[model samples]
Target: MPGERTKYAWRSHILAERALVGAAEHAREAAELATAIEPLAGADDVVCAYVPIRGEPGDLRMLDALCVRNATVLLPVTGEPGPLSWARYEGPDSLRKARFGLLEPTTATLPPDTVATATTVLVPALAVDLRGVRLGRGAGYYDRTLGAVGDGTRLIAVVRDNELVDRLPEEPHDRRMGWAVTPGGGLRELGHELPVSPE
Candidate 1:
């Protein structure tokens, strides 16, 4: 069953991509929902977002919305599997080709302390369980970066509607999400700890 689960999980990238492309409208709605849910995003404060690689959910829309609202956007420069560093996003012109179909920071670079000042982090996830456990792209990037937010930070998992399931297979090092955002639905809080309900 574990092998089967892994197979299904691997295929989720494509399946979720279809879901996201089909529900592009929901992406926009989710963006608006984000602005409404976190009015602080509209402020001049900085929010970190990923240059969406696969069809995870809400890539440019989220970043563009934040920037359009006058919020400073910070993107991660993928380093080793440890804590992440932040670089200033200078609009669309600063993006450049990178591995894993992702975009990298080419314009400005910020210190680690500045990234620690981020109020929000838009993390990419495969499937997030009700217990807040997030199954990422198997890269463990987010798991390492979650702690980089310092204290009192909010990490929102961006995924498709179906991707937020009742449970996900958990590993010890896996990190949890404070909140989740999807298109079809608004935002949901996974603040409290919930059991994984082992299959």
Candidate 2:
């Protein structure tokens, strides 16, 4: 309960800060993020990514970029609060609005454990610490989904440059990310990459 409270406080603080970013900045960051993440993708690589909504960093353009590489992109299909089911990302045309303002694929649904098939999993985050602990939007979808990931799956948290923090509140059920893909910073391995300057 204490950790959940701390995570809630951090989410509120970080979101407030994200709301201050300008549209131009978001566009630029989105482009940079697309470029940063493409190298992590390869032909036929299965990449599990989310569609951005609200002010969440790195728009679906990141997914599009991965798609351009011939990667099999899968997006979350919202269901009960647990490991998410997935669907093939057919493109921008195939997304339909789902609950909580989330966009999901309109294609056939894949099993929740489909994430185990991905070589890389890109998840939305409010903030992530240098040690790879990620703070999500209080929904336990990712925490549950990540539990099913393969041992070799590269779990990368997608966030803005500012969202990578010095530390974040973490819990026993919280899974650690292996890397973070930021706009200006590209992909940095957690706990091993040099600290990003807060300036």
Query: Candidate 1: where are CA atoms >4 Å away?
Result: 1-40, 111-113, 192-199
In candidate 2, position 104 carries an lDDT of 91
Could you tell me the C-alpha RMSD of candidate 1 in Å?
3.9
How many angstroms is residue 12 displaced in model 2 relative to the true structure, after the best TM-score fit?
1.1
TM-score of candidate 2 to 2 decimals: 0.92
How do the residues 52-153 of candidate 2 rate in per-residue lDDT, one tens digit apiece? 889988887898899889999999988777789999998899999999999998999999989999999998999888889999988898999999998799
lDDT score, residue 105, model 2? 89
State the local distance difference test value for candidate 2: 0.88
Best by TM-score: 2
Please give the lDDT score for candidate 1: 0.69
**Residues 90-113 of candidate 1: C-alpha lDDT, one tens digit per residue:** 777889887667788896666555
lDDT of each: 0.69, 0.88
- TM-score per candidate: 0.78, 0.92
Best lDDT among the predictions, by candidate number: 2
